[model samples]
Target chain A: MDHNWDFASVLANKTLLLIGLKNTLVLGSVCLALGLFFGLFVGAARFSGKSWLYYPATAFVELFRNTPVLVQIMWFFFAFPIIAPFKIDAFTAATLGLTLNTVAFSSEIYRAGLQSIHKGQWEAGKALGMSYWQQMRRVVLPQAVRRMLPAFMNRAVELFKMTSLASVIAYGELMYQAKVVSTISFNPIEMYTSVALIFFLVLFPATILVRRFEARDTFRR
Target chain B: MTEVLRIEGLHKSFAELEVLKGIDLSVNKGETVVLLGASGSGKSTLLRCVNFMEIPTSGRIHLEGKAIGSARNGRVAYAERELTQLRSRVGMVFQHFNLFPHMTALENVMEGPRTVLKCDSSECRRRGEKYLDKVGLGWKADAYPSQLSGGQQQRIAIARALAMEPEIMLFDEATSALDPELVGEVLETMKELAEEGMTMLIVTHELGFAYTVADKVLFLSEGSILEQGTPAEVLTYPRQDATKNFLRGHNMFRLPEPQID
Candidate 1:
């Protein structure tokens, strides 16, 4: 019978789409930056070779990583304000939940990069009279960054995609906007299709870039 | 000669395995002390302990009359604030060369001086070049470790250490990992360093390198000093059975000697 597709109505709601797109991009980018920094710090803490730091960091990673992100979103949005000493908003809840979630997974990537370093490199730096921090800053991290790049970028893409889950907290990211647009337009297929298309448009080149990074790093080796 | 490095009762054990059985030794200023041993004899461990790379289970190490890196009562005194300062005085070259892979030969040499000494960039670069040239690697200053030959990489490592102008140099079988033909070049660089009156403690199996360059030779067997004397005395005319056995098959690794009946 009639296989009719109308993207016109959904796409015509330019303001709604723009707001959603902007929020999604903003949330994704901000959380990504925060996640990367958090991941590196947590990763460093885990491998700091000190039992005090390592155990807690490992526990923290396990707590977040082993749980579903949606549960974390529930925790931040619903449970946090009840248990916490302060009030919060949906956006803050989404950001906090997403940041912690991203940090948990990416820290493993960071740990892998850090572990790839030879013990001799640390000793060489030490013998040259550099402190542990100095060795890390001067010798270890530079090499680790190169090795960690593709994984880190992959994680970043994942982070951006994961921001779609922020809609669960009523934070009004892309997926939320798409849901709203579909509800208003009575066109689930069209609105959702647009949403999927937007994600593909943003993340496909990113995947290719990650692969290129993997290739370049291999060639560098 | 004044003592550059003096160690007393240096002992180290990995779990239940005692890798160093109370090594007592003194290296005089400008003395080239070669540690000769078969694999697992703890020669590398002894060399490592001197620089606090491996904390001695018990010992005192004195560098230039300063008892540092560990306390007198075998307790590790964390010179946490001054560890970098302590490390600056002891330079070590590894069997694998361990040149910072991401950096150029020149940058690897430059790192210690620039970071620890706070040497200015141009000055560090100039000194890096000078030391690279000293080790006959002036032309390869820009090459990465993977790009350079093993011998060339080891030479750059030597240059990296020398750039710091360390009071004593430690070579933990620096030539052991090199290609056979490549071994000579690194040995020659080390020999030149010895002649220039740089105090050296070398762990090596190259008997000829030991005979030619060592003022003192120590033979380690099963984590203890089995023999110690002049190279002619320890290498050529070894007194201990362990030293004799080690010398009989110096380069014959991983094989029983053919029974010449």
Candidate 2:
């Protein structure tokens, strides 16, 4: 069977695809900002020696990390509103699931980065009369953040891809919009191919940049 | 002479293992005391105890006559906030130098003053420059730790500690990590500090340096002090078998003839 590959239909709906792209960016940025901001504190809690902090943080991380992102999104959107105190829209549910997932994964990255620093660095700070926070802010984080950079960028890439799962909840993100356009135009192949190309175009440069960061000896000796 | 630091009945334990068993020692103002011992002899632990880096199982540490921790029943209880303030007054240099790899030499030195002392950037820079000059690393102030040699890094470490203007400096085998040739530069910097009348408690295996610079020397063995005296008495004529055995292995450098005053 010979099939003609026509690109006109896909290009004609550029406005709709553009709207989908905007929604995707908005969702991805919001979740990333909230996840990383809160992830540091949760990461510190996971790194804490005290059982009070460590146990709860461990449980939170394990629960989110062990489950699938799709299931989490479905649970938030379909099942959560019954006991929920406030109205849960598709965007809110998707944000809740994706942000927590990012938090769980990124927190581990933060924890590992902090752990990689030598104990002597902490002692050096303490010996200089720096408080615990001072040691972390001035000494530990400055060094740890550099090592954590590549890992965080990798997380951002994974997070952007995971945003597609919001389509299951009909969140009107890029993937959801693509599905609607494909069903309406009866061009599943072109619509889906266009979505793949769009993702590759956005993410390929980011991955190359992350590899460069990883390859360079940024944290010398 | 005024006493700058005093440790009395200092005991430290890691679970079932006792590393420092009821040790007692003191350093007066501007005095240089050298601690000699084998690896597990508790010299490092004793130095760490002074800064509360290794919390004492039971003991008392006095810095200029102020007790470091509150005695609770039989054990000493320390508040971390108190320890932070106490540590600022007692600088320490490690074997690995422990310089912040990300910061320049000047920034590393200025960190203590800027963050802990809450000094303005200009004031911190002045103190940073002064100490770097003292350690003979003023020219390398803009260099990162990774860019410097081990000896240069160690000198910068000394500058970083000195920037705090600590009342007494502790050197825990400060030159042990350097190359054999680089060791001399760090030791030279340390000797200059000792000569400048800076109170110092140094744990090192450099017997030659101890013989010349130390006002008092203490030999530690199996978590206890085995001998204590001038370099002449302890290095030349150690009475204990443990001290004698430790010295024999370290006879690579000849001891200078005891200067009879």
TM-scores for every predicted model:
0.94, 0.96
By DockQ thresholds, what CAPRI class is model 1?
medium
Residue pairs clashing in model 1 are none
lDDT of 2 at A207: 100
**Mind giving the per-residue lDDT tens digits that candidate 2 earns over B1-261?**
999999999899999999999999999999999999999999999999999888888889999989887877776789998999999999999999999998999999999999999999899999999999998889998898999999999999999999999999999999998899999999999899999999999999999899999999999998999899999999999999999988888985665897899
lDDT of 1 by residue, B1-261 (tens): 799999988889999999998889999999999998889989998998888788788877888888876455637676666656777988899998888988888999998889999999999999999999898888988788888889899999999999999999999989889889999999999999999999999998789899999999998888888889998898778888877877878646644677798
Candidate 2 fraction of reference contacts recovered: 0.84
Q: Evaluate model 2: give its TM-score.
A: 0.96
Total colliding residue pairs, candidate 2: 0
Local accuracy of candidate 1 as per-residue lDDT tens digits, A46-110: 98889999999999999999998888987999999999999889888988988998888889989
**Candidate 2, A1-221: lDDT as tens digits:** 47778778899988889889889989999999999988998899988878999999999999999999999999999999999988999999999999999999999999999999999999899999999999999999988999999999999999999999999989988999999998998888989999999999999999999999999896465
Highest TM-score, which number?
2
Question: Which lDDT values do the candidates have, in the order given?
Answer: 0.88, 0.93
